[model samples]
Target: MLLTVKIGKKTEKLKLNRKEKILKILKKLGLNRENVVCKLNGKIVTEEEYVGTKDKLEIIIIVSGD
Candidate 1:
């Protein structure tokens, strides 16, 4: 399946296993799981939701600025 991912300031299309979790995508991007939030469509999702095949996902890294 194909998923649209939003990372940093860009949106890109990625082909993922239908049941792949957000962590898999994050791992691909070299992002630490604790440092990012994963959203599907518009709602915040738990790891389980990402584990479900229904995740049409987008990810945004929450950064702290000084």
Candidate 2:
């Protein structure tokens, strides 16, 4: 399954063999789950959310300020 991922300003096309957790997907992309938010098909989803092929995933980086 091929998943389309958009992180910040970059877009990536990932090939996945099966459904997996959002956290694992983040790790595959060398991303920290704690520092980003996952959105599936325009809907906010948790790290535990299962994603598969033909899914549109958006990774939003969390920013902090003093």
Candidate 3:
């Protein structure tokens, strides 16, 4: 399955397995899984959220102020 990622102002396309999670995709993309957060369809998501082609995913990377 392919998931679309909206990080900041850039949108990137990712191809992953249907069972893959946002964290896996993030890691594949060289994103720090500990620092990045994910949201799917405008809702906050956990690491267990299933990634499917039917889902239009939104991934957000959280930055620490300190």
- Per-candidate TM vs. native? 0.74, 0.90, 0.77
Candidate 2 residue spans exceeding 4 A from truth: none
After superposition on all CA atoms, what RMSD does each candidate show versus the true structure? 2.3, 1.1, 1.8
Q: What is the C-alpha lDDT of each candidate?
A: 0.73, 0.90, 0.74
Give the winner by TM-score: 1 or 2. Answer: 2
Please write out the lDDT profile of model 3 over residues 1-66, one tens digit for every residue. 566778867898888665677777777878876776778887888856777776766766786798
Model 1, clash count?
A: 0
- Looking at candidate 1, the ten consecutive residues that score lowest on lDDT are 47-56
Give the total clashing residue pairs for model 2.
0
TM-score of predicted structure 1: 0.74
Ranking by lDDT: 2, 3, 1
| Predicted structure with the largest TM-score when compared to the true one | 2
Error of 1 at 60 (Å): 1.4
What lDDT tens digits, residue by residue, belong to model 1 across residues 1-66? 667777868887777666676777787878887888887877888645564444457677888898
